[model samples]
Target: MRITENLIFSTVLQLLEERPVSKITVTDIVRRCQINRNTFYYHFAGMEDLVQHLLQAKTKEFLGLKRRFRRPVTFLFYMMLVASKYKTVVLNLYHSDMRGALEATIESICHHYTHLYMASLQKMNLSDTDRELLIRYWKTIASGIFLDWLKHDMEYDMPHAIKRICFLMAGNKDLSSFDQLKN
Candidate 1:
């Protein structure tokens, strides 16, 4: 069942590379996968569901890879690497109405890592609201950078961009105040 599902997914990705998602249908996916509509329906309800599942699978893959990195910097490095690898697919989804789902998944990932990074900073003391605010703050920054990169067709070097972000954060002395989130 998983293999069949993967086949459908891979087919969708391949088709996506060649055409817009709005034009891809379950019939197209099934025909390419060499499976009948029943098989595709068995795994996913429809194109939208398949797309959602694919995005989720990608997010899980990213999260799994990120777990190996203890530092937020390295986590971000891997994150950008994954994004760069899937730049085209990401851009496709970003431009589509499915953008909300992709953005939500990215925000969830950013929130998770931001929480980890804040917790790792033993000196930092943040209230519940402050922590939420910080998470939202970083999520916006990370999502904005990624979206901007996607909007520009990823013309820039992502790794360098990540390094630049790290440099800015390290050099911003005033940002230290963020270590202690006030009311």
Candidate 2:
């Protein structure tokens, strides 16, 4: 059952790379997977359900990673790198009705890592509200960067751009002296 589900999931992702989500139907998915509609429906309620499941599965996969980073910026970089691997799929979802699901996944990832980073700071004391606000702020910034990249068709050097943004956020006055974090 899991194997069939995975096959369906991968087929959808492959289809997404070729066309936008709006253009994809369950028939297309089942046809590509060589599965019947009953099998597809047994695993997914509809296209939206499949998309939500896909996003949730992706978020769980990312959260399951054992490698923990001391800095949230590093986590953000890693997340972006992973997303860049499926550029067309991401862009397709971003421009489709499923954009909210994609954004929620990004926010979930950002919040998880940001909270972990905050918890690692043993010397700092923050009120719950303040901590929430800080996480939200960083989440917004990270989401903005990602959406902006998609908006511009992802032509720029993401790593260098992220490093520069991190340096600026760190309050480094000399742009020429800014050094990328050795992660």
Candidate 3:
């Protein structure tokens, strides 16, 4: 991200903590960053464009976190950690008309991580349809839980909650197992 873009991004996120995205204008962002409207326009086409860029940028950061952990569950834990870290901005997006941006980001993260998980299961033989269904299933489950946490003001122990849910899912014999995971 360019310096000006980063400045505008941070400004928008900070402003989001105080107001909804729909209510925030490019002028407000430039004014907060102490820059002119033209600068904001130069960096972003408009407020919606800025919001989408921010979402994709942040999603990349979370996906990058997957490289540090070998286990899919650990990668997921990091995802929750980030959500908790940015609770204020997340809640702001949730209540705003741009909620889909947040949801799309979550789905993208889950989808990428699920592909990694499936790749790790070398002996698992799932059809293309099943694989797609599986990815969507995990994506929905993960995103649903994360959104639930956001909706409830993030009062729960997210890491522990995710761990328990994983344990429960893994413990179900009929749900298919990852026991064939490559060492």
- The candidate maximizing lDDT is 2
Q: lDDT score, residue 38, model 3?
A: 78
Alpha carbon lDDT of each predicted model? 0.74, 0.82, 0.75
**Across residues 16-50, which tens digit of lDDT does each residue of candidate 1 receive?**
77777788888788778889888788888888899
Residues forming the 10-long window of minimal summed lDDT in candidate 1: 174-183
TM-score of each: 0.80, 0.86, 0.81
Model 3 agreement with the true structure over 101-172: per-residue lDDT tens digits:
878887788778877776665566888788777667666766777778877878888888866766666677
- The order by descending lDDT is 2, 3, 1
Q: Relative to the unseen true structure, what is the Cα RMSD of model 2?
A: 3.6
| Candidate closer to the true structure by lDDT (higher is better), 1 or 2 | 2
Score candidate 1 by lDDT.
Answer: 0.74
